[model samples]
Target chain A: MEINHTVIDSVPILAVSGRIDATTSRDLENALNGLIEEDNNRIIVDLAGVEYISSVGLRVMLAALKKVRPKQGDLMLASLQPFVREVFEITGFTKLFLICPDQREAISKMKTG
Target chain B: MMGINREITVPARLGEIPAISDFIYEVMSACGFDAKKIMEMQLAAEEACTNISNYAYEERNGQIHITAAAEDDLHLTLEDWGTPFDPTSRIAPVTESPAEERPIGGLGIYLIKNCVDEIHYQHRDGKNILKLVKNKD
Candidate 1:
């Protein structure tokens, strides 16, 4: 998977592309953990480019959420493709995280709070 | 419609998951499964195969044999010579729980159950065989 890191209005945005399965979730886990370790708690993950995600990928996101929530920060998701979104929905993860239609909305929400 | 059958063997290791997924993708696509169904089957196959790779063999190296056949439905059978365990025997995780309160371990099998139409497990001749089926009709 390809992960591009950027800052949108000071919120760290990770745009992930490619399939996220057991083989590639570690890369995502490390990147998210690295961001959390650096004290960047409020984060947004852009899944518009991601075509697939398995439970391993979900586990990484869950772990990241657990870490960031304690610091008064949250990991928001935006632009999920249909298949990826279904996984979250089936797993009931849609209710667990803040999901927005785009990065602009996510950034706006983050700035408002 | 004509039937198709194919099989592959990969080392029971995390690194082989992508290859296994690729194989599933190719066969499922050849079976005329739509993009959405293809992705669902891929996820289900990966979860099952990854579990075998991670827990079936323990510390010793082993092989996972995956067979795919498509007729009226798509069938995937995974066989391994490692420990005998039934993935379907576990209860599905509670999806209604809040994220923080939810545990992490059971999601794999949950995905497998949710994505596919049918699943069966058998231990024969000391080999654990897992069968997953998705109907096209």
Candidate 2:
């Protein structure tokens, strides 16, 4: 997977592409952890390029969310692929996350809420 | 459709998941599963095999053998010669609990259960066999 980081309106956005599995998730974990350590709390993960996500992949984000939430920060996932969205819905992860249909809404949430 | 038990054997490593997933797609497609159903099975397969690769073999290198058989329902049987551990023994995760309150790692088994219509697990001769069955749609 390829992860590119950019700042949008003071909110860090990670655009992740490729399939996320146990092995490839290291890059994502590193990216998220780096941002968290840097005190960039509220972040948006753009998964438009990500076509598939496994449970292990989900665990990385969940762990990061848990870590950042203590600082009153949250991780918002935006632009999920259809298959990925269905997996989240089936796993009931939609309740645990702030998922937006697009990056615009996620950035807005980071600013407004 | 009656299939003649298509199967593949690969090293039990995280990197082998893509090949396994491809094999799963082929078998499931041959058994006439839809796109969404095939993805569900693929996800479950990855989750199940991941547990085996992470915990079952430990320091020893092992191989994961998967068998796809469909006479009525599609059943993908994953067999590993690593230490016998029953992934299905774990109870379903409480999705009702707040995400902060829930554990992170247990989602694998829960997702494996949710993707399939029926699941069966057994240990025989130092092999852990997990059978994920999806009904024909």
Candidate 3:
């Protein structure tokens, strides 16, 4: 998978493209780790380019969340496809993170809330 | 004589995930599954294969051996030499928590179990094998 990241008003925005499965999940983990190292506690993962996501992907996200929580930061999600949303709901992750309809909304919510 | 079981194996590299998912979809479709079933099976297979690639090896790259069979039913087995954790035995993702409180780690296994008709796991001969089956009428 290809991951493009940028800093938007102090928040690290990771725009992920490709299928996030068992094999490519580590790349994601590495990306998250980089963010953590940078002390960018507030994160927004844009999944608009992500065609698919699996449990390994979720696990990576969980690990990242755990890492950021101690620092009093949060990971948010935006623009999930229907199929990806279904998996999140099935696993109860729809409740674990702040999910927004789009990247702008996620960024706005992070700024305001 | 009975025909031999046909199989295909691919290396479990990060770049090969899409090919693996597509292969599983093709195998399920060839077994007469409808488009919806094929997509579901594909997602489940993708989840399992991705896990193998992500957690099976720490330093050295290892192969994820995938064997797909279509006869009386559809079977997709993924074998890896990584850690010996069985995803099938994992607890379901927390369901009672709200979107902001629920954890994120168990969604893949949950999706796999929910999408497939049958699923099993075994660690034997120093390999972790995840077997999934889907039947069609």
Among the numbered candidates, top TM-score falls to 1
Model 1 lDDT, residue B47, Cα: 83
What TM-score, computed on C-alpha atoms, does each candidate reach?
0.95, 0.90, 0.71
Q: Worst 10-residue stretch by lDDT in candidate 3 chain A? A: A50-59
Q: Per-residue lDDT tens digits of candidate 1, residues A16-99?
A: 999998889999999999999899999999999999999889889989998999989999999999999999998888988899
Q: Score the docking of each candidate (DockQ).
A: 0.72, 0.57, 0.36
lDDT of 3 at A80: 94
Pairs with backbone N, CA or C atoms under 3 Å apart (clashes), candidate 1 = none
lDDT of 3 by residue, B9-70 (tens): 76766567678767877676666677666767878877676667666664347787778777
Candidate 3's C-alpha runs over 4 A off are B1-6, B10-19, B29-36, B46-73, B77-108, B120-131, B135-137
Tens digit per residue, CA lDDT, model 1, B12-116? 888888888889888888888888888888898888877786667773699999999998789999999998878877646665666445333367788888899
What count of clashes does model 1 give? 0
Model 2's alpha-carbon lDDT is 0.86
Rank all candidate structures by their TM-score, best first, as comma-separated numbers: 1, 2, 3
Off by over 4 Å in 2: B1-4, B93-95, B98-105
**Ranking according to DockQ, highest score first:** 1, 2, 3
